[model samples]
Target: MASPTPYRDENRRRLRSALVAAARDLTVAHGWPGVTMAAVAKLAGVSRQTVYNEFTDKAGLAEALARHEIEHFVDAVSTRLHEHGGDARAAAHAAVLHTLAEAARNPLIKAVLTSARGGADELLPYLTTRSELVLAAASAAIHDWAAARLTDPDPDRLALAAESVVRLTVSHIVQPSAPAERTATALAEVFTRLLG
Candidate 1:
């Protein structure tokens, strides 16, 4: 067996990033149902074969995109929580509201959610399952924050709270009877109460 070359690994990473960015852009510009592998390949300036090599199919590509988005979201939340300092509930609330607001405005998320019916039903399942992974990631971040800030952290309880917060926010995203600001504020209140 040969060891992987750093140069080759770097190139692969670049290509994968290109594919993910292209997929996201295309999905946002066109609806999720309209985004095709060929379009992504063209947008990424990579060969169709390269796209396929990196991601087996559209579903695989979408999953990669979702994973990337989730990781980015978690990082952002972690940063915000760190910056807030000494207030776990406030940090959690701000993180939840910020994430929900982003999700509400994200074109890719909107496209997937809106096109969940008909042939595009797969989009909803993909997004919902990916959301579970996201929630797990967020839960880990919350656990770390709680451990650092709280007098005595309960990892399992914090994880459960994170999951509940994410699910509630997602519900609001799926159907918003209230305004975005109000919904976010309400969610933040609930999160603060839960964390307390």
Candidate 2:
């Protein structure tokens, strides 16, 4: 069946965004385990039933939050990649530099990495070992972009390179280091060469 009016869709999006925003804030301040549907409902000014109606359950909300975070990073990475024009090296360098900085400070990421500090951080696994959502999304996006930019298309090679970039970069996010800039620069060099 056809959808409803644009207004309805917009309202739906607005409510969903608000709920996610509320959940994120609560999670960051109180930890994932500390957050509940009731708290999200109160913060978002919606009823508890409304939160469940939109998210199904706590796990669903966490998954949505993870997807939102990954998508944001994917968009930023795409923009950074394109900003370098046609220079693969320059694009990779810029993308790497931008990505590492975001990863370090991103609250969603902090929520996961700082699990010991607070909360069960159930969402962390969805980003890391439990699911391949981040890796798959990132690799596919990078592969598509790199394929279009390449003079000679090589599917296997391009896939491997993109996967490497996503996996290695995400690994650093999971464990981190004293300085991410150095890692970003080195990885950018490798990815640049792979694409070049």
Candidate 3:
């Protein structure tokens, strides 16, 4: 079998990106229920068939959008971790602060939270209930940071720290009881204990 041509791969990537972008914008504007495959195709300036070709189905499309956004968040977290170099506490503090602040500002996250105010909740499962992807991705990012700074970091300890940090920060994003700085500081203290 022949390998996919470079032009074919590029076109596929571009089309998938366009579809995901369109779906994300529509989802932000009007809950997931409001976004239809037809609407996504129209917004993407592509045929419905093309959208299906790229994503297979609605579930696939939703997965793609979630992955895109989650990875974007991971990138931000990675950057914040790197900003603190070898200071595990500072890295934890910075990453938590940055992530929570961004979650408050991100349109898709806002959309999901806001949709709870009305009748149906169509878009939150990907983030809240069915959140394995989000948790796993976040845990991986946190583990990477911890592993880089901790002395021969134990896998179990790294996993524990990662899950603790992600779950704590996600709780804050879902419902902020205190300011992020305080939360970050507190979380950093925990990290210092775990990694110290």
lDDT of 3 by residue, 15-106 (tens): 88889999999989988778889999999998898888888888889889989998999899998998888788889899999998899889
Instruction: Sort by lDDT, best first.
Output: 3, 2, 1
What candidate 1 gets wrong by more than 4 Å, as runs, is 117-119
Using lDDT as the measure, name the better of candidate 1 and candidate 3.
3
What's the CA error at residue 157 for candidate 1, in Å?
A: 2.0
For residue 70, give model 3's deviation from the true position in Å. 0.5
| TM-score, model 1 to reference | 0.88
What TM-score number comes out for model 2? 0.89
TM-score for each model: 0.88, 0.89, 0.91
Candidate of highest lDDT:
3
TM-score of 3: 0.91
lDDT of each: 0.76, 0.80, 0.84
Q: Mind giving the per-residue lDDT tens digits that candidate 1 earns over 1-196?
A: 9988999999889989988998888877877777888889899887888888888998898788878877888898888777777576568667867877788877877877777744575566644654677677877887777777777755566666777777776677666677766776677677666656
Q: Give a tens-digit lDDT track for model 2, residues 1-196.
A: 9879999999999999999999899888877887899999999999999999999999889988888888898888888877776666777767777888898888867876686345475887866676588887777667656766657757776777777777778777777664777887888778876655
Which ten contiguous residues of candidate 3 have the minimum total lDDT? 116-125
Q: Model 1 misses residue 165 by how many Å?
A: 0.8
Residues forming the 10-long window of minimal summed lDDT in candidate 2: 112-121
User: Which pairs of residues collide in model 1?
Assistant: none
